[model samples]
Target: MSKAHLPTPPDFLIKEFASFQPKDRQAIAIKVAKLERKVFPAIEHFNYDVELKKKNIGMVLAFKEDDTDTVVAYLVYQRMKRLVWLHKLCVLEQEREKGLGKRLIEFLRTQMEKGGCQIHLWVDSNRKPAMALYKSCGFQQIEYRPDYYGPGRAALKMELSIGE
Candidate 1:
């Protein structure tokens, strides 16, 4: 990705959910899990209980500045040295087109740049809006895998190099 600046949406406050108290984090996890099921296909849905316990995994959630308890969007990623794998990015259906997705990507990029990490992800080819969002954040297409999702669905592998 280019070094161009990416602006965060001012209405939403995004932060790593790990910093919260165990009880609060558990509450957010339940909401996130429910949101994931509503937004993502079953094939792509993750088990937040198991995923949240990983040391390498990180979850960034976006909440309305006025309402810290409700999650409006989220981005999940795994970092290992200079490589970061972006696992999932989702915004509640009612919250789409408000730049939440790009904001989350920019947030991750800015944080990972300190360590010169390269972010990688495979987006389902059928999701045009998602592809556009990532591309807008300067993610370059690296490869295309046919039938990666199923018999007809495909996947596009993309990457964004941060300060590398």
Candidate 2:
């Protein structure tokens, strides 16, 4: 990835992460978990409550200011030293092609770039839309793992190194 040029999507419905109160925290987690379950198959489901409780993991959710209950998209990541591992990136089926997923990724990059030097994630090779989205954001495939998701579901390890 070129440090000199980072792709920025048009300002879309991105509500950058915010400090959530205790109640808000649980509410958001449950909401996001629900969204994940609806969008991803059971095999790919995550325990949002447990993951968000850890210190290094964080998530960014996008929703309309007027209707926060309807979560349009979310990005979950785990930070380790200078590297951030993207756990999941999901946007509602009704919300695709609107640049929400890219914005969520860009939002995460902007939030982590100061302390984090790179972002890495394993994407299911069968998921073409996801592959395209990450590639559009300058992530390059670093490795390929066959059956990482299950037999016949290959996974691609991709990375984007931030400016040094």
Candidate 3:
């Protein structure tokens, strides 16, 4: 499909990826696995314990209309102290560059404001596109590590103080 064919998320659509459920075990696992493959390919396996904890945490999943709804994007986060740590943000290949990421981040900031936390996330150093997107959204890189993502993959810790 052409770039213009990318779907715009609906204004009436809700912004939340209700945490995975035991009954949804298979579906959630498949979705999460696909996400990890495309986004965290270097990681051999996901941390199940941490993922289980994420079930109780807040999240957002953006869906676009099709014959049946399809998840176009998603965000996973948790609060630590006064910081809102975004653990994951994924937008399908077809959905990228359509401004869905911007809307998702803005929604996260609003969620942080209501919860009284500042938003932050750990980004891979080489992900220039993600860094640019975060920068455009007012996120500043506050820290960096030479090999934070294991082996040669480095990381940039970014923060966005909300409701200030």
Candidate 4:
């Protein structure tokens, strides 16, 4: 059977946390926390303090649905020297398979390439969809840690070279 193609996303607004008020950032963080709880109950959620700091360089992609502003997705990464470590990329459950995650990764890649940084990320070995997404985005698996998260759990470390 042929796989169904995901539709192109509508034009959504992307903003960094610095553009939002402290309360707004907190709201986004809460949403992120809830998503993590639902999606990866075995993993530890990101601390709000660290996530807020990472948001300064990351982005929140959102839109209005039924007259209510909603954060459909967000990217959290940290820049260190010539490397960009992708800490988290979350898309609302209903928004999955619609290309928002890929768009967010591509957006970050373009921005990081301008600064000559390579992007790196790690995904749970069990998450086949996420592994495929990273691979589709040009990330190659560089390492595998059998117990990166804990016993019986593993992680795949992947990297994408943005520039020389």
For TM-score, the strongest prediction is 1
Across 47-152, the per-residue lDDT of candidate 2 in tens digits comes to: 8767777889887777765676778898889989899999999988987998888888888888777854899999999999999999999999999999999999
Instruction: Put down candidate 4 lDDT per residue, 73-129, tens digits, no spaces.
Output: 777788787988898887778878878788778777766666577888889898888
TM-score for predicted model 1 compared with the true structure: 0.92
Worst 10 residues of 1 by lDDT: 1-10
Ranking according to TM-score, highest score first: 1, 2, 4, 3
Which pairs of residues collide in candidate 1?
A: none
Compare candidates 2 and 4 on lDDT and give the better one.
2
Each model's Cα RMSD: 3.6, 4.4, 6.0, 6.2
Colliding residue pairs in candidate 3: 17-60
Candidate 3, superposed: residue stretches over 4 Å from native: 1-14, 19-29, 42-56
RMSD of 2: 4.4
Model 2 weakest 10-residue run by lDDT: 3-12
Q: TM-scores, in order shown?
A: 0.92, 0.88, 0.76, 0.80
Index of the highest-lDDT prediction: 1
Question: What's the residue-level lDDT of 62 in candidate 2?
Answer: 77
- CA shift of 33, model 1, Å: 0.3
Task: Show model 1 residue runs off by greater than 4 Å.
Answer: 1-7
**C-alpha local distance difference test of each model:** 0.88, 0.81, 0.68, 0.72
